[model samples]
Target: MFAMLVRLYLTVAGLLLCSMLLVQQAFPYLFPDQYSQSARHEFSGELALLREHLRGVGIGELPERIAALNRSNPDRYSVLSPAMALRLPARVLAELAASGTASDHVSTEHHHVYVRLDHGDVVQISYDESDFPIRYIAYATVFAMVLVGLMIWLQPHWRDLERLRDAAARFGDGDLNARARLPGGSSIRQLCVYFNNMADQIGCLIQSQRDMVNAASHELRTPITRLEFGLANLGDTLDDRVARARVHALRCDVEELDLLVGELLTLGMLERSGPMPALERIDLSAFLRASTGVSAEELRIRSTHIEWELAPALKEVVVEPRSLGRAFSNLMRNALRYADGTIRVGAEAVEHGWQLVVEDDGVGIPPEDRLRVFEPFYRLDRSRDRATGGFGLGLSIVRQVIDRHGGEIHIESSPLGGARFVMRIPWHQPGEWRGRSRAPREEPAADAGHFEHSFHLQ
Candidate 1:
């Protein structure tokens, strides 16, 4: 707010200074004769009075009379000798010689007049220049008043803008209920109304999408369960081997469809706008071990070696256990499919949070496709076949889970020559942790290295 005020003040100040300069430059052109006419009108009376005083006064007594006039008047009075009068500008001297009276302005504040007496003395009348500082002080007071008025005008507008900015930020961060509430007389009231309308439309659209996905997933479950049961019964009745194999294939297809529906349901749940899931404080090391072990056992990938690199400093983290566990399981299963012989699942302490990494020793994802891999139904060309690829909702669900935990996940090139999925989650969830007891640590095997512990599958 201070920065914004400073910028506004500087802009206003610059414009005012520029306007003063432009007016100064254009004033003469705009009113060329006004200055001269006003100056003449002003000093005409003074010149007449001086002339009356000097009339019939002898040249020798002119200096005494001028001194008396100077002591009584605010303006200076002087008598110029013929030689001194010769030093005047030719224009002024000529004008005085022709009209017996002349006026000249040295600057905007300094004015001078000359009159020719009958005794050949030039009586000079001029304004004093000592009031220059007073003029500057007046200008400064005016400018200060203008500054105060500007500040008064900007205060309410700045306050309104800040409220709008905060509402927009909260809305962007997924608070669909956030709205900018401003006074009716506020200058930006229309803008606030527009923003609120936009937010409403967007919130309704997202809610609609979630509701549709939920409805579809629920609708699919019944048919999928019936088909699975029918396929199982039909397979049992089949006698021929080829027919049984075909029935098994159909069952597999139905199972895949059911899995897809389940993923869609989970995605919809994660995307719902509401309070977060209940959080539990769990030991990072135990969670990693359990998640990786479960995924390996489920996939039955015994040939691949799993290594754990748990940082000692990382003790416990607050998270929704079920959702985070599912995310880690998905990452492990993904690594299992692409790993050549080894997979690394590791956790380490980092600034503000902890880092979880799952990497394999297979071909790394291309840089261009790393981010897109987290989009639902997105897969690389090489993983297009059913044997290697999933329905492609796994990584999308992983991202949603991380987002729910107020964390971020990204893919990087692994040191082991494959795609590395890194999840960074904060150490604590707001208003969630209640100081639970830490899980008992598992002792490392004697052969485990100092940097990491290993769980050999085969």
Candidate 2:
């Protein structure tokens, strides 16, 4: 704000300087004669001295300078006294001289002039005094015009600065939409344009974080209530095996709740700010295989067959290790949850970059629900809920992490009649593929016909 004010002041000062230059150019024409009244009095005295000096030198035939000099009546120059007469050429002296001019003794008080010729004649001259009033009005008009012009030039700049200050104040008060209007297509427009873009990004992040928290809280409420009710019922049970079973179920519910809260907190913190992205070259194929192994093992323990493949063209990428790990983990978990037969993880090189596909031979999501699944805590099967157990933040967290890394994640139907999750993280360069292949995605027969949206319940 201080800086903006300084700029505004400088702009106004420049305008004022320009106005001053213009006024100086028009000053003489607007105010006609510039001579002072005192200068005119001095001119009269010099004329009298010149007349005396000319007469002493025996050239007294010269006419006075100030002959009753009305241009309208030039045929008769008004006469003044000999003492007040100013010298001029002998030709002008003959024109102004007249006979019997004693009655025309021009008034010295009015600075009139009279002259006599060698023929003993005299003539008088005087000036009209009315031009001074017109000159005074013209001077006042010109001064007022310059002052008004200066104000007119500066008004727009002042208004623009005030508007900018008001917008900044509103933004400080949390009105993120407040924007300074930049006048004229100049550097100021560039500044305002950039500031507005920054504000828009900030608003989106803030609103997204708020929505995430609200949805997470709402998703957690049901499992928490169920946990509380189950515990209350457990206190009244007497059977050992039944109580143990109920307690185990309660423990699972508690763990699910804890997981949901932890994931939400992670998403929130990621929204606020996270570690700066460090770009390091890494073998992406190895990274995906290693990360998916943990989930693959867990699924295998349940006798679930999974397939992992790494393409020869799949190369390394420049990315943050932890964020990439998180995104890969989410994709693996989502596949593990619904895979009935096989889960295939592989990468392929494309012109844009590398495309990583996490495909499973399970029922793909309905077309309408695919987009909604990317939202936090938005589960498609309401019956399974959190008790059957995933908090539904898996895809959302995946998207967030990928977005931060400037990559894109896409969802579509797989060739194996299952969901296909495609992630494209641009490879750093050509010929960087480096990782061993795991087994191909396989589908088991037991879960074939039983595949439905409520696979967790089954």
Candidate 3:
């Protein structure tokens, strides 16, 4: 801080001195009369006051008395024109010649005072430049004060800049969360906010990548271990039936491994940074029924029921159909695992876009676990047992796909006494959508009721 102040002081002082020197060098020729006339006006009052004081002394023997005064004070006082050979400017000579009064005053280029006396001679008073270095000192002092004030104003800016530099340095050194905190009212607050935002996004991205790598490594172990155990058993087994069962178990393990890898790849694609996928305008009702129809049949074998009926007005929605279908499939499969007898699914237009709801009438998630249930490899207590639950990658896939669609998913207590997962997804093209009628969709053939349309709207 001291070094900065010193530098500013020197720089500002140098420029001020140079500028003053330039004005002094050019003033006589460029603005000759302006400065000279003002200077004369200023000292004119002093000259008149002195003349008044000397009025009592009388001017009868002015020339003789001036010579005596000059002899007495060689430096401070001088008598001019009549006796001393002091050179005067032509303008001053003309003014003196034309004046009706005796005490006419004029200013000189060398910065002297001239006063014409009644005795037809002029009195000159020349000031030595050395005696008043205080004037130049006054200018420097004012410049110093101004420079100090400027430094005070700039101190906060410099401090903020230094803080930002340190934050960037720490980030470069692998501190992912390093961020600059500046005062709210500071001049560079907007810049600091943008920097902090960028840092946060970078940190989130890296953390997500880390989570993916760790979870993939951990989850791949079960199937690989099973395959190894199956290989160990294959050569030693004697019974044909036992061998067939072992082969079936091996095939299932291989299929599970393939499914896990496929899901992982899909999740990675969703999380990766890229341009948005091209959208297709599709009938939302037909798409929903077709996608859920397969899931409903699969669940029927396990005696699981899914109640899905798309609203008629929700027909045309712009979206990446394949990816969105995968997300919906995830929700369907997830609901089936926990649903006791019935699963409810539907879509409705909301203020911004569409809200797809999946609810089950089974065990609802605990309040504490609701937030983290969407994370990869996050399994509920029931789900930890493979007999009842999956590998825990299903909801994670749903979340990634939903996030890629620029939407959010939230969980709440269902009206059906189970967990309700609301995937609030916005339309791909916001400009094309407005309010549309919520007419009913074509009814599916009822086989003593497949599933219920569970929306409680009267």
> Which candidate ranks first by TM-score, i.e. highest?
1
User: How would you encode candidate 2's per-residue C-alpha lDDT over 21-139 as one tens digit per residue?
Assistant: 56645543353223212323444564455345444332243344323233445644543445444454343344344321112112212323444534433444344444459755875
lDDT of 3 by residue, 226-278 (tens): 77676657735746877767776766666677666766777766655444467
- What is candidate 3's CA lDDT for residue 258? 61
Q: Return the TM-score for each candidate structure.
A: 0.84, 0.46, 0.49
RMSD to the true structure for each prediction, in A, is 7.1, 16.5, 16.1
Name the candidate, 1 or 3, with the larger TM-score value.
1
Candidate 1 C-alpha lDDT tens digits along 1-458: 67877787788878887887667566634664475456557788877877787789887787788777778774488788889999998867877878787766665456677888877788877885647698678768877877787789889999999999989987776667889999999999999999999999999998888898899999999999999999999999999999999999999899989989998998888776577656888888888788763444544544777888877877888788888888898888888878887888878765556678889998989977876888888877545656685778888889878766666677778889998887766667545534322222234334322312121100
Stretches of model 1 off by over 4 angstroms after superposition: 22-32, 40-49, 67-75, 80-102, 115-122, 128-131, 293-302, 429-458
Local lDDT at 343 for model 1: 87
Q: Ten consecutive residues with minimal summed lDDT in candidate 3?
A: 100-109
Each prediction's whole-model lDDT (CA): 0.77, 0.59, 0.67
Top-lDDT candidate index:
1
* Candidates 2 and 3, the one with greater TM-score: 3
Model 2 lowest lDDT segment of ten: 449-458
What's the lDDT for residue 97 in model 1? 77
